[model samples]
Target: MPLLTINLNPAVDTVCRVKSFNTHHVNRAYEVVKTAGGKGNNVARIARSAGEEVYSLCFLGGASGAWIAKQLTESGIYPVSVEVGEDTRTCIAVVDERDNSVTELLEPGPVISQEQQNRLLDKLLDLLRSKTFDCITLSGSLPKGLTNEWLDQLFAELCSHDIPFIVDTSDSRVLDLLHHKPTVIKPNVQELESWMGTAIREENDMIQAGYDLCRKGAKAAVVSRGEKGLLAIRKECIYKVSVPKVNPVSTVGAGDALVAGLALGFINQLPWPEILRKSAGFGTAATLSYTTGRIDSGSLPSLVNQVTIKKIQPV
Candidate 1:
């Protein structure tokens, strides 16, 4: 079964390479690259690269949206988009190769209308009814005009459908959907800290926070700690994962790649340890590439070998 990824707010990501980026000064880029982006789209791209059949559902508007669709097609991800009135947003990422850092400037996407939001929801229901999918992933932030009440209803519908879902969004409102009990949730350290309303100062703090989230509704909570590695917490078990150090070209899409790996693992019904291993490998592999939301499939085997998974007592 294919993995369905939903991205309500999509963007054309422009990555510019500059030796040094100085604020308030004119800076020239040595190279420029653009690609389809958004957390869900990134998940789809990485999943496709990992040899999984993937479908991306998103809103497309104007020329920028059309370009994203074309790019997805070229990347072998089926784009299932709803046409919207406003042009899609563009995000800029300045990569400083000299320091191996990336600075991102993001734009709030086109404000969606009630009618457009309803249309997108309808399209999602239509697809869910028509196709057989292994899992569904809802990523990125909710666009404008999409309210908490609307999401509550939509999540209720998903619950009724009984489809396994993985949610990887930055929106705080996502916490409201936890009652529906998504199969898994991926949140970075900062996002997790915000949601849990506590400081994640160390591994044990993160593990406790993750488990607390599982207690609320999620079957599992995967907390990403950047280069520090990830902690996956379930009700009874916890897995601590660490990846071998590597020179990262860019860390832009590592989280999305991790989500993709976790989705694939869930689809295949792999053990939680294996899932953590795969997720860590995919996330680390993505760091080797300069492009956002991409990984070298060939490097996965070695990377997977380098991932260390330790089962710890649930905190």
Candidate 2:
């Protein structure tokens, strides 16, 4: 079965390389690369690279949107695009080679009209009725003009279908939709801390937060800690995944790659340890490449093997 990914605020991502990257001085970029971007789109790309069929649903507008659609198609992902009036946004990331730092400039994206919002919902419902997907992933932030009520309604409708949902977003509004009980929620450590309104000072605190998310209606919570690897929390057990260190070229889309790996694992019914190991490997591999969302397929297996998974059974 194919996986379905939804990207509400997609963008054309431009990545530039700067040698030193001075704050007040004019910096020259030696290399520049552009690719189809957005959290959901990145998941689609990585999943497709792993030989899974993926369908990407998104709002597209103007020339940039058309280009993204074309690139997704060329990448072997089926695009289900809804047309809008405004052009899609562009995000720029400046990578400093000296210290491996990334500075990003993100646009607010287009304002989606009421009619467009309804059309997107209708399209999603129609697609659900027409095809069977292994899982549905809701990723990224909402664009302007989309309301919290609309998000609640979307979650309600999606839950009525009896399919599993994997949500990966930093938007705090997702806390409200947990009543609908999503299968999995992927949030970075910073995002989790923001949601909890407390700092995760220790491993125990992190584990407690994950369990708290479960009590709030999520079946499982996967917390991504950059460089430190991932922490997977479930009702019965918890997993701490550690990835092998590598010289990272870019950190863009690493979280999305981890989400993709989790989705793939769920789709294939793998054990929790293997699932987390693969997720850590995918995330680590993404950092080895300069392009956003792209991973080194050749090194994936070795990376997977290098991953260390520790499972803890909660008392």
Model 2: how far residue 105 lies from native, Å: 0.8
Per residue, candidate 1 scores C-alpha lDDT tens digits across 1-315 of 699999999999899999999889998999998989988898998888778888998999999999999999998999998888889999999998778788899989988877887887898888888888888888887788787778887777766666678888888887778888888888898998888787778777888778777877888999988887888888988888999888888999899999988888878989888888888999999999888888977788999999998888755
lDDT of each: 0.87, 0.90
Looking at model 1, report the run of 10 residues with the lowest lDDT sum: 155-164
| Local lDDT at 216 for model 1 | 75
For residues 32-138, could you state the per-residue lDDT of candidate 2 as single tens digits? 99989999999999999889999999999999999999999999999998999999999999999998899999998999988889999999988998898888998
User: Where does candidate 2 stray beyond 4 Å?
Assistant: none
For all predicted structures, in order, the TM-scores are: 0.96, 0.97
The collision pairs in model 1 are: none
